[model samples]
Target: MATQGRSTLDRRRFLGLSAAGAAALGLGMAGSAAAQTPSGASRMPPSIAALGPVLGKAVPIADDEYRARLAKAQRLLAEQGMDAVFIGAGTTLRYFVDLNWWGSERTAGVLLTRSGDPIYITPEFERSRAMEQVRFGSEIRTWQENQSPFDLIARTLRDRGIATGTLGIEEQLPFFMADGIGKAAPQLHLVSATPVTAGCRAVKSEAEIALLQIANDATLACYHAVWQALQPGMTQQDVQALVAQAYGRMGVRGFVDINVGKYTAQPHGSIEPQKIVEGTVVILDDGCQVHGYTSDITRTFVLGKASDKMKRVFSIVQQAQIAAREAARTGGMMGDIDAAARKVIADGGYGPGYKYFTHRLGHGIGMDMHEWYYAVGDSRQPILSNMTLSDEPGIYIPGEFGVRLEECMVTTPAGGRWFTPQSPSIELPFG
Candidate 1:
């Protein structure tokens, strides 16, 4: 998939991927036959050990793409009648400028005007560091200690001939920063930048879809490999170790939460110790990233064999997932998609609304796992082509077990399409 790739060191710094963390997850080098106890390497089955890196075709987003994104945002700002948008030091910042800055007490961000170049803001001490990753713009205004960065922002705006109109603030900006800006520039009206930011981000470009595809494919492969290596008596932690090892073998950092038996009834699972046994359900949830795009998949199955009830629930959930996908047509209301899926689950004896299906059908997936817009009952947001989202429908029955089948999908004129094929059955999840 076409994604923006970073060096392993950079990815580690950004994602906080550590050898110790990996080792804790039971990750080890591939093709090593020597069994070492006390480490997860000893438990690493031959199926997982034989896997190799699949990131050879992964590509990084080019500087031109970042510039294009800025251009689109600028157009949106003009159309929305906003003079400029203040983007904070997080995913929105990274999305537009390719800068992976960590937010702190200090103020740092970008002020993009509708008519001119993007202006970056940062601490004077971190000017050089900011420059290294500021891929879209050249003008960076810095602030010194004991000085108000908010004042600097006001000054920058006035200098750009934007002294008195509405200013859109990135939705994720800290409250203190927003309040500070309001006090410093009482002449400016602040509003949410969702119209501009989400307008640009909600839909995926071909390159981004490719990246998401690779990410989802990698996660599915990891699940398949780990499923083959499962054994009785393995704890949830042991399975997590195997998942980590599988991703490590594929040369990507990933994560998963495991639930065994009745614990699978919990949507997010529990930290309470769980062990696999015959005829019990097990749930593996979460996924990995390729470049910056992410994949979120959940697979529920059994180590030995599923009971008749388990099979029935699985079939209903799977059908609901498919119904949601088929209803996700471009120009259709987002709520309609959720309704279609909920109807399937309800008819199958699950819910009237969020009773057995406890949460929304799915959420938008992109650079962040959960982004703007969602597939839920109350949303009236219009589905658009190239928009990527999750088609996850789950039925949770407390004190027993639960079934959830999730697959990230993309919207098209023909409806929704999955990045990877859906789980064929509980016993053949990867298929």
Candidate 2:
């Protein structure tokens, strides 16, 4: 059975040692202790305590950076002969302002034009919070609950001299919004502007990478804490609650949609009501989101004693993960990187059906948990340096068990670097 507080004690000791060791190495204590620890910890990680101060000292994106980004967008619009880029949706809003907002209401949106500063059309209730954080170079237009935000958006476009030309729309725009915009402004042309946004977010600056590193470190702490707390009789939901509680205590927000899965059920099935039985293969696919950045991790564990089949499956998946990691070079073919692991499983006689894995090998992770860049089923895009992605491949035997292993990796010239160091062992119910 997994021991509660075992890894938490280790984490506390590790942070203490890290601080002392850093001083011994002629380097000052760096990063937040809390941010450094993962989601499920009894004690705050050293990084969380230290990160705020360190990050404060660290260089932030200058005002010029945002201006430059806006300028680039403008250049793209000019090249396409468009007057404005109609950006809507969560990801696009965050990309432009780096501000976080709730998706509860329809009042949150922005209409960016080449001629004026970005126009923010937010709900009456959230306008206060939006104005406090969101930076709009020009005028901000607010829409009340009674008024349609899109209607105001169209009216603003007309008043600001933006009509009769191409309007760039985010790929994730709601169908309703698309229709409304078309009806409101019939002469306007809207095209998918995903490529433009992707180009801006694909390349991570040093500051962005540091934030990600901090988030990853914190998530690892949470993962270790949850594993330490796991018990044989606990249900998957219990473990999930425990993990979330651990994260909450440490002042870290868990992923918006966490995947706390059990390998005991049929493939892709929901967690059953029964407690996690001994010999069950359990996997916790969760992450901690910090400062709008996310860390995705998955660990497969056995409840009590590991069976021979469990060991074999874990070994195969672990080795396949290694192969996939090795193939992801800075300039290598993405298809090759994906094939490395799939080939391993296919050669192991599991075939590509149940053992083949259901989802793609991995996807880019940053602002969004699942971004556009992919490793599998995408043959053309090559791996680029500084791109962070998850490597998840698994085999699921229906009505028996589900086994999946996932870890985040950042692309580099040599290959990929694990955001968080791989756990020492995959054996569950660590004894």
Candidate 3:
């Protein structure tokens, strides 16, 4: 739909925040997150999948969408001049097969070519579900869990007469997986397939956008619920528990990694166990996931009233966020919008350089929280309609306090529309 709106913000207020600002609210950050572990791996914390139906269905790709996405991938293969694009990364596998199962013991992959039907190679244990989800492919090959899955993949290619052709491998392929594939198919020339896949997945389709909008609405609802659940003297952990409960009740299937901080204005500081005391500035950043789509939002609040310094930082950040959002348009350079936000932060005398603003203006959010098209100092990617990203800007004034306001935005035929509601202004009670 149409994606543009004027932000109605009041920026002239400089007052104290809630002197007794203590409550649990959902808050998150805008940076690189830890690499996700394969499903059931002990190295990483358990994912929502471990929570069973509490996180939702195991259906990743299903029915019509599955067929449509595969057809799209085949088209991309032709455009990239590759005979077969190897797909094994979590994002790629999720895109093609819709299975979220993971393991390092046996590598699972697919070979999508421009001419022939698609082929899947997975461990024998996963073969049944893979067969169920992989409806359009022409061949399904399963290797025993004890044997090399890459060997089966190589056999499939050989049996299909795919010799003397370039094999497109994902840039994100694990080193171990790549080594195994190299050993199995030494005759095939391997090249990076990121460009082909990136071109295919960068622009959101109407259906994808609709799913993201639903996720956004659910996210906003969760945020408001968490705010209402807050109370003075509540620990940060308590607030996090409330976020998980609220989001779960809303049908959001995701883990709740909530960060709550007071006086600690820097974005990455630990949310300690201290009681949220009076005159504290609280930042809540949280997200809710539906299917694989996720909505990220951030809001700064005062538990009771507004403090003088808190109000100033809040207003400046709100202004910056508005400016960045409004400037985002099709064909516009991403750097310019970021520069706009940085300029505002600097003009407010928050200092003239990177010292005050430590992070990028925004980042793309999709299948994974932070995906591509980041709005950073060096990035010059132009904004495109149908792309989705976060429009987050904040001024971190070390030790003293930090203020950041953020929302997810969807680029439309006309411009960009915010997915989540505009967070409240920086002042008492954060209303």
Candidate 4:
């Protein structure tokens, strides 16, 4: 589940340990004393306090990977019949050039031609800052404060011999930028860059998968620790605090949205104050990031014993998750995956499509929490190998409780494999 607000706990604020240092400290062992909560009323449990960083196996995307990504984008441009592609300062730019730039009123991005090096456009004053992060490109074009950056973009395209062909604009690029560029280059046609950007990003490389795996593993570990630490009378905020502390102990920044009792029925959660009690259902959603890659997992359980109805609902949701996973084979239609999960939920008595299963089966997951190629009944996109997605199936019953089981999965030649095992039961969520 996605939350509107996030409270991040920097790893450095707690352990501040390097990956090697964390490994030496030992995994599954308590490294330091528990820190007091912001209210100074409680200390974290031993399970959470014992958590240690698990990023030792994680490797950031290397320079070669960036170059290869650029190569793939260029190949996609050529195949799509576009002269050059404009990548604004965002994830798309980061994906190709390794430039972690923020977009503002001023324009800053890269222009990749069909046959030449990438041309970076930025304000004249920010050129030095852009230089620090441009790992793959060299030709930097600058526009003074009095000049128009769109004009600079048009001229750069002409300089690269792209006089009158189609130019693919990054889908997330601002409308003003696109409109300005269109007006500046009336001869060139502007089109969506999804065919090129999503074409390359939707597929995950082995290295990307490895990073995602570790991120998911770390999140599950944090969840397990937090679950062990749960107690009666803890507020929803307290549980969220525990989650942040667990990630802090693990030496990674993370966030979570805590939902209790009837509020759990709301997929994104509620802002009302909620207290945990015996037999009350609690749902923990969201996950941490490892090397800019994200992991999203949701676990629902009770602090004490679960009622019979809750168990039955949990089982149905679990089965739905499995059904969706089984249907996510390479070459299968993406819609089929959603249909498979919805069928299980409906057949289990929550029928008539979207009645209880409130949302789509899952969404594409990678650097961003929600990406391309979603798994919805109306989607007809083909599921391909190496595509990573979430297999989240939920049953929300208003004024009662909801059960959602989410796990990130990668599509393999064999089929879809989850980064972590599905929750066995409500009582034993991590299993």
What are the models' TM-scores?
Answer: 0.93, 0.77, 0.80, 0.92
lDDT measured at residue 256 in model 1 versus the true structure, 0 to 100: 71
Candidate 1 Cα RMSD after full superposition onto the native fold (Å): 4.4
- Looking at candidate 2, the ten consecutive residues that score lowest on lDDT are 1-10
Score candidate 4 by lDDT.
0.83
For all candidates, what are the clash counts?
A: 4, 28, 21, 0
Off by over 4 Å in 1: 1-22, 25-43
lDDT value for model 3: 0.64
Greater TM-score among 2 and 4 belongs to 4
**Clash number for model 1?**
4
Q: Which of 2 and 4 is the better model by lDDT? A: 4
Query: Who is ahead in lDDT, 2 or 3?
Result: 3
TM-score of 2: 0.77
| lDDT (tens digit, per residue) of candidate 4 on 110-210 | 99987767889999999899888776757888999999999999998888887899999998889999999999999999999999999999999999999
Where does candidate 3 have its weakest 10-residue lDDT segment? 6-15
Q: Give candidate 3 misplaced runs (Cα > 4 Å).
A: 1-62, 255-263, 428-431
* lDDT leaderboard ranking: 4, 1, 3, 2
Instruction: Estimate the TM-score for candidate 1.
Output: 0.93
Preferred candidate (lDDT higher): 1 or 3? 1
Top TM-score hit: 1
Q: After superposition, how far is residue 108 of candidate 1 from its true place, in Å?
A: 0.2
Error of 4 at 255 (Å): 0.7
